[model samples]
Target: MLDKVKELNEKFKTASPQEVLEYFLKTYKGKIALSSSFGAEDQVLTDMILKQDKSAKIFTLDTGRLPYETYSVMDNTNLKYNIKVDVYFPDAKEVETLYKEQGINGFYESIENRKRCCFVRKIAPLQRALQGLNIWITGLRASQSITREAMHLVEYDENNKVIKLNPLLLWSEEDVWDYIKTHKVPYNKLHDHGYPSIGCAPCTRAIKEGKDIRSGRWWWENPEHKECGLHKK
Candidate 1:
């Protein structure tokens, strides 16, 4: 799988994002899926994938603590595309135990607590969402943060044992917005108010204009520790 992913990256080095989507959507078919977060980049991918294949799988993880705007855009996306995007949620028992152990917002106290919260709310649910899949599509861009700087167009996610496809890996922040506006894609309202990166309501915030796009997410932690284990290398 690793060798295949390397070959794929080489083959699509100069391909357009749509071209990448078209090939994966047809070749992999039911064995592939896009894990959307309903952010600008993901919204763009959703439009491209649906345009090529309406039956293409696109899913999102509902952390249960997401902001209202995230849900709002999610509904708008479903209406616009006329397809109900699949949603995955964390285990009820795990969430219950998390609260008991952390007391609602214990994530603020330490990195361990925060990671624990993310595991229960995001990672665990994501693992379930990726089950039995050969390819996992994402909206990750290299410029988003330090953690994502070394990502490739296609790579193997050993954590999930799937070929991770980053269709928008090389897209710029400007490129993402341009695609969104050109396509008139439904995006999260939070982006209009300075939230460059949107996640669960409590974990995300609006960043200053010049800050890193990912600065808004997990703002309390160091840049190196910002990731929630979803795209862990």
Candidate 2:
């Protein structure tokens, strides 16, 4: 599987994102799906994927703490595409246990607590969502953060035991916005308010003009520890 991933990376290194999607969507058929967060990059991919295959699977993890704007764009994307995106949520019992163990926002106290929160709210749900899938598509870009710099166009996610595909891995922030504008794709309103990265409401914020794109997400943590375990390598 690792060798296959390596081969795919080589094969599509020079291919456009649409070309990559075209091959994988057909090859994997019902086995491939995109996990969207309704962000700009994801929105662009959604447009591309739906244009190619309206019945393509696209799902999102609703952490129950997402910002209103995230939900707003989710609705707009559904309306624009005329498709109901599948939604996955954390286990109710796990969420209850998490709150009991860590109050309302204990993630603010320590990195350990934050990771635990992410596990309950995002990672665990993501695990469930990825079940029965051979390929997991994402909107990750290398320039978004220090953690993502080493990512490839296609790689095996040993943790999830699935082939992880990052269609927009090489896209620039400018490239993403250009595609968004050119296509008139529906996007989160928070992007207009300086939010380069959006996540659960409490874990996200708006960054200043020159800050790192991911700085707005989990702003309280060091760059190396900013990830919420969803994309952990």
| Model 2: ten consecutive residues of lowest lDDT | 224-233
Give lDDT for model 2.
0.94
Q: Write candidate 1's Cα lDDT for 47-112 as tens digits.
A: 999999999999999999999999999999999999999999999999999999989989999999
Judging by lDDT against the true structure, name the best candidate: 2
Q: Count the backbone clashes (under 3 Å) in each candidate.
A: 0, 0
lDDT for each of the candidates?
0.93, 0.94
Q: What would the per-residue lDDT of candidate 2 be over residues 86-158, giving only the tens digit for each residue?
A: 9999999999998999999999999999999999989999999999999999999999998999999998888
Candidate 2 lands at a TM-score of 0.99
Misplaced by over 4 Å in model 1 are: none
Alpha-carbon deviation at 229 in model 2, angstroms: 0.6
lDDT of 1: 0.93
All candidates' TM-scores? Answer: 0.99, 0.99
For the record, the alpha-carbon RMSD of candidate 2 to the native fold, in angstroms, is: 0.6
